[model samples]
Target: MPELPEVEAVCRKLRRDALGASIVQLRVERPSVTRPQDPAHLESETPGRRIESIERRGKNILIHLSAGHILHIHLRMTGNLYVIPDVRFRPSLARLWIELDGGRGLIFEDSRVLGKVHLHPAAHLARVLKDVGIEPLSSAFTLDNFTRAAKASSQPSKIFLMDQRRVAGLGNIYAAEALFRARVNPRQSARSISKPKLANLHTAIQDILHHAVSSADAAYAEPGHFAEGESFPCAVYDREGEPCTICGKPIRRIAQGGRSTYFCPRCQR
Candidate 1:
C-alpha cells in the first residue's frame, strides 16, 4: 500500500493532469470496481460531471466535482492512476477509466484488485473517514498534540504510531524511519517517552516524512512517474542485515502488530 507521500505524489499528478477535465467516458472494465455503485446507478451518477480539483486526505484522494459530489479513491495496494494522450489508452489491467475532456483519461489500474472508488458529497464522507486521526503534516498536529495522542495509548511505540486513529497516515516504513531517527526502540511503551525525547520524536516524524517527500520529488522527473518509493525509501525499512547509515551497526527486523518493522537495534533505544 502506498503511504502518505506516495498518495501525495499521486494527488499532485491527478490535480495537474485530470483536474477540470470533463468525464466524457466512464469505462468499467472490471465489474468488481463499480459493484458498489452497481452498473445502472454508476452510469447515472458518473458522467457529465467536471472534475474541479484534486486533494489528498490522509491516504485517500478526493476528486472534487462541480456537481456537488466528490469521487473518493483509495489506491489500496498495487493500484495507480495514469494519464496519457491517446484516447485508445485503457487500463493495461485497468479496472476503471474516467475520460476527461479531449483525449486525456484517468485510468485506475490495480493488479491486486484491492483499490476502491466511491462517489459521495464532501459532507457525507466524514462518516467514512472520521475515524482517521490527525494529519501529522497539518498545522494542527503539534508536539504537545503528538504527546497527548501517544500517551493516550500505552501500546508499543510502533503500535501507537501505526494507529491511524491516533496519528494519521503512518505506515511501517515511515514509522521505522521516525523511530530510528528518534533513537527509541519500537517496542517501548508510548507513555514512557520523555518530553524532550517525545519532542525529538515529533520533530523526527515530520522531518523524516518531509525529507522523503522532497527526495521522492527529486528522485522522479514527473510526479506521475513515481516508480517505487515504498519498497525501501530510507535508512532502515529494508536495510536489514546491512550497515546502518548512522552507526554502522547491522540493521534488524521484527514483527509488530502484524507488520514487519526495521530498525538499527544497537542504535535505537
Candidate 2:
C-alpha cells in the first residue's frame, strides 16, 4: 500500500502536471477497480472537465475537478500512478488511464487490483472520507490530541499508530520507524506509554513523515526517477536483520495486526 508520503508525492506530481488540464478521455480496463458499480459514470462525468487540484487524505488521492466533482483513488497495494508526457509504451497492469489535454496522460496501474476508484460530488467527498482520522501533517493533530487518543487505546503501539481512526496516513513502515526513533517498543500497549514518551513519539511521527515527503520530493525533482519507479529511502522499514543505524544491533521484525513491523529491539525499548 502507498502510505502517506507516497500518496502525497503522487498528489504533488498531479497538482503540477494534471491540474488545469482538461480530461480528454477515461478508460477502465478492469471494471472492479471503479466504484458506483458503474464504469460509465467515470467515463461520462470526467470528459472535458478541468482538474482543479489534487490532494491526499489519509492514503487516498483526491483529484478535484471543475463542476464540483471529485475523483477519489485508493492505491491499496502494489498500485502506482504515473504521469507520462508522451506515451512511449504503456506499462503492464495499467488499469485506469486518463487522457489529458496536450497529450499528457495519467495512468493508474495495480498488479494486485486491490485499488479502488470512485467519483463523487465535491460536497460528498467529506461523507466518503468521514471515517478517516485527522491528517497527521495538519496543525489539528496536536500533541494533546495524540495523547488523548493514545490514552483510550489498549492495542499495541504499532497497531495503534496504524489505525486510521486514531491518526490518519500511518502504516507499518512509519509506525515502526517512529517507535524506534522514540525508543518505545512497538509491542507496548498504547495506554501504557508515559506522557513524555508519547511526546517523543509525537515529534518522531511528524519529523519522520515530513522528512519522508521531502526525500520523495527531492527524488522526483530529478528527471527520470518517477518513471523508473525507484524505491524511497527508509531508516528501518523492511530492514529486518540489518544492523540498527542507532545502536548497531541487528534490527528485528515482528507480526502486528498481520503486518510486519521492523524495529531496533535494542534501541527501541
Candidate 3:
C-alpha cells in the first residue's frame, strides 16, 4: 500500500534521475510484475526515445515517453523501484530491469507479487484513468463533493476514506494520519461529523498529504539520509499502544472494514 506520497516520491526520482535516458535492454523475471507487451515492439519504440516528463495520476506513476507512450508503474504493497547505475548493485527481488545506454537502469523490485507496470499510448492514458476520482490535492476536490460523498455513505469515515472508488489514492496510513490530524474518531459515522469538522477534515487531508510529499521530496533530493523503506514518524499509524503525540493518553487500535485503524481516543474524539 504505497500511498500517494510514496508514489509521488518514486515519480520524482524517475523524473530527476531516469529521464533523458535510453533503454538498451530489458529483462522481466516476473511477467505479472508488469504486463508484457511485445518486447520487440517496446525495444523498437522505447529505445532512442527520451523521457519527456513524469507525472502521477492518483497512485499511478506515469513516465511520459518521447514516443507518445506512457510507462505506468503501480507499485503495490512491498513494491520498490531502484534507479542504479550498476546492475550488480541493484536491489534484491528485482522483477524487471530496463537497461539504459550507460550502466544506469530502472529496476522494478518487489517482494510481493502485487505490483504492475503497463505501457499505454498517450491518447489512451486519459481513458485508462478516467474512472479515478479527482486528486485530493487538486482544486477539483471541492468541499461540497467531499462532504456529499461522505454523507452518502453508511460507512465509517475511516472506511469511506479507504474507498478508492469514492476518493482516489488514500490508503491505510494516510487515512489514519489524516483522521488524527482532523480530530475525527475512526469509528464515527461519516455523516455524523459536523460541518466545521468536515471542513477541517478536508484541510487536514490536504495538509498532511502536502507535508508528506514535501518530506518525500527532501528525502529524494538527499538520499544519503533518506533510508530506503523508511516511513515517516506517524502520530497514530503503526503505534498501537504508543503515547499520543498530542495528548498523554495512549493511542488505540480498532479493526474496521477488515483493516486496523490507530488513533488516540482523547485526541480524535
Candidate 4:
C-alpha cells in the first residue's frame, strides 16, 4: 500500500502536471474501480470541471475539482497514477483515465484491482475519510498529541503506530522503521513506554516520514514513473537476520498483528 510519503509524492506530481487543467473526458475501463456510484455519473459530471488542486490525506489522493466535486482515489496496493501524453496512453492497462484539456492524461492502473475510486461532493469528504487520523507530517502531529495517544493505547507500540485511527498513513514498513529508529521494541506496550522514549518515538516518526517524502520527491524522475519501495532507505524493515546498521547486532523479525516487523534486538529494547 502507498503510505504517507508515497501518496504525498504522487500528489505533488499531479499538482505539477494536472492542476488547472480541465477534465475533457473520464474513461473507466474497469467500472469496478468506481463502485456503488454510477460510472455514468462520473463520466458525465467530471468533464468540463477544472482541477483546482491536488491533495493527499492519509493514503488517499484527492483531486479537487470545480463545482465542489472531489475525485477520491485509494491505491490500496499495486495501484499507480501516471500522467502522460495522450499519445502514450495504454487502454489495456488503465483502470481509469482522466483526459486533460492540454493533450495530457492521468492514468490509474492497478493490476490487482484492489484500488478504489469515488466521486462525491466536497461536503461528503468528511464522511468518506472519517476513519483516517492525523497526518504525521502535518503541524498538528505535535509531541504532546503523539504522547497522549500513545500513552492512552494498550496496544503494542508497532500496532499503535500502524493504527489508522491514531496516526494516519503509517503501514507495516514505516512503522517498523520508526520503531527501530526510536530504539523501541515492536512488542513493547504503548502505555508502558517511558516518556523520554515516547518523545524519541515521536520525533523519529516525523523525521523518518519527512526524509522519506523528500527522498521520494528527489527520486521521482518523470511522469508515468511511480516510485518503487527500494527507492526509499530502510533501517530494519525486511532486513531480518541482517546486521543492524548501528549496533552490528543481527536484526530480528517477529510477527505482530499478522505483519512481519524487523528490529535489532540489541539496539531496540
Q: What is each predicted model's overall lDDT from 0 to 1?
A: 0.80, 0.85, 0.80, 0.86
lDDT of 2 by residue, 16-122 (tens): 77778898998898998995458988999899999888888899899899999998999987777868886435676889888888877788989899999889999
Which TM-score value belongs to model 1? 0.92
lDDT per residue, candidate 4, 109-220, as tens digits? 8988889988999999999899988889899999889988988999999999999999999988899999988899889999998988889989999998988888777666
lDDT of 3 by residue, 214-249 (tens): 877667667533344344668899898889988879
Name the candidate, 1 or 2, with the larger lDDT value.
2
lDDT (C-alpha) at residue 171 in model 3: 88
Taking every candidate in turn, the Cα RMSD to the unseen true structure, in Å, is 2.1, 1.9, 2.4, 1.6
Candidate 3 lowest-lDDT run of ten: 223-232
Model 1 spans with C-alpha error above 4 angstroms: 34-40, 219-226, 230-233
TM, every model: 0.92, 0.93, 0.89, 0.94
From the highest TM-score down, the ranking of the candidates is 4, 2, 1, 3
Pairs that collide, model 3: none
Model 2 weakest 10-residue run by lDDT: 223-232
The superposed Cα distance between candidate 1 and the true structure at residue 119, in angstroms, equals: 1.0
Best by lDDT: 4
Instruction: Point out where model 2 deviates above 4 Å.
Output: 227-233
Please give the lDDT score for candidate 2: 0.85
> Lowest-lDDT window of 10 residues in candidate 1?
217-226
Off by over 4 Å in 4: none
